[model samples]
Target: MKEHKTTPTQEKVLEGMDKVYENLIEFKKKANSDLVVMENGKIIRIKPSTL
Candidate 1:
């Protein structure tokens, strides 16, 4: 099987996502409520339980 590696941009994005995930976890613990985020110009609410 061929091995694949992440490019610099992909690595950067992954790192950012990791930070976001951590922040979300903390936010959920403190806020005890759903998270609100804007995606594709639409406002979406994500339940902490769903995460």
Candidate 2:
């Protein structure tokens, strides 16, 4: 495999990932729940018990 370096865009993407993780923590705190449901990076369902 070839070694690759992150470009500016790749670095930005990494930053976005960090933000997403942080936001997920916030979501869990404010919702007081861990029943997060997502599809394609967007919330499609929440508090789902019947599936």
Candidate 3:
């Protein structure tokens, strides 16, 4: 197994991305909206409740 190293700035960016993702999920749930994403080269819509 190999270990990956990230710079401090990279770590902060990754953390920010995670927070944004969490907020997006929360927004979707509250808005009763579907999350659109790509899977196996296909576009799909998933209900937030499914999460």
Best by TM-score: 3
Worst 10 residues of 2 by lDDT: 42-51
Which residue segments of model 3 deviate by more than 4 Å? 1-3
Q: Candidate 1 vs candidate 2: which has greater lDDT?
A: 1
C-alpha RMSD of each candidate structure in angstroms: 4.5, 5.8, 1.5
Per-model TM-score on C-alpha atoms: 0.61, 0.57, 0.88
Model 1: per-residue Cα lDDT over 13-43, one tens digit each = 9999999999978889688798889999999
lDDT of each: 0.89, 0.73, 0.96
lDDT of model 2 at residue 20?
96
TM-score of predicted structure 2: 0.57
How do all the candidates rank in terms of lDDT, highest first?
3, 1, 2
Q: Provide the clash count, candidate 3.
A: 0
Better of 1 and 2 by TM-score: 1
lDDT per residue as tens, model 2, 10-48: 999999999998887677667666555678989765542
Any idea what lDDT model 1 has? 0.89
Local accuracy of candidate 3 as per-residue lDDT tens digits, 1-51: 999999999999999999999999999999999999999999999998897
